[model samples]
Target: MPYTTAPVLPPGTLSRSPQPVLPTGDGLVLRPWRGRDVAAVHEAFQDPLMHQWHIRRSDSEAEVAGWIEGWEKEWEGERDAQWAVVDADSDRLLGRVALRSIHLVDGLAKVAYWTTAAARGQGVATRATATLTRWAFEEIGFHRLELLHAVANEPSCRVAEKAGFALEGVKRSAALHQDGWHDMHLHGRVRGD
Candidate 1:
């Protein structure tokens, strides 16, 4: 693992200050994605839990290439910011956490994340969520952040709870899982609320 410098902020001037890279308790650093991260990301995506929770199998090589392209675009300020979670001590890629669906006007964004199976039960998701949430509220000045999880994902729900996100409510048949439609728990945390 190597220490990579932060991506240059996107072209247009941002109304808010640039988001800073922060380190979590276990020397896990939350920073922007890099080209070298593609392999690690692809490896993590191969995990069955990752497929069930995040990536859709229909995601082809082209689609992944497009995503990596978008990652650069996002870094250049053309899109919402995303990050790769890396170990500060070993500089190994552990997972990814991002604030997506950014609506600057509404002051709202959705937080989504997944950890490598090897990193589970180590509080990686919880710490990453907390670090990113703090960045969203303080650095990006977002008023609200949302974390949504499928009802079946107990571990994810626990991560949300541990990160201080309130269980707002569940939407019945909100999304279609592989088997069928399922409920989704929507968790929220607001700045100063």
Candidate 2:
């Protein structure tokens, strides 16, 4: 069942040849992940919000480091693009944003993001999402980008709206979290929208 033909597009069509750095124009920088970011990444995931929303959890530094390494592999395969959201002034970790499940044939992708507790309420997620959306649409030539979050996560919904993603609809009981199945709201933005 594993055997199949090649993908619709050759490698490097979805992801940038060299991952680009995106600046939010508000002192927030989105850049490639580094090995040295393990500590900060580990700490950020320790936040209760991350645990509540994100299914993947990293309990140890080694696990966090592996996660960072996977980002590079994702880029190499043109499967997805991830960036560490950092503060330009101090190079501190603010959060992370990524384009996941990128399908070149459909010209569609999903956006996922998280913000450290300290960085929340400062528009970090909104800014990062907006910057990434623009980059994906204009630079990478993606036709559409989508974002989904548990219906209970109001802040994330707000971020999606502020980033210009329109609410499409809700997928009832579509996501499983620690609290069990939760309804998810899907928001999307198409090129030129």
Best by lDDT: 2
TM-score of 1: 0.84
In Å, residue 110's CA in model 1 sits off its true spot by 0.6
Residue 53's C-alpha lDDT in candidate 2? Answer: 92
lDDT by residue for model 2 over 1-193, one digit each (tens)?
Answer: 5327554444568554678888888899999999999999999888888889999877999999899999967887766889999999898999999999988766788999999999999999999999999998887678899999999999999999999999999999998998799999999999999
lDDT per model vs. reference: 0.77, 0.89
- Give stretches of model 1 more than 4 Å off: 1-19, 58-63, 75-79
TM-score of each model, in listed order: 0.84, 0.93
Model 2 regions lying over 4 Å from their true place: 1-11, 14-16
Judge candidate 1 at residue 53 and give its lDDT. Answer: 68
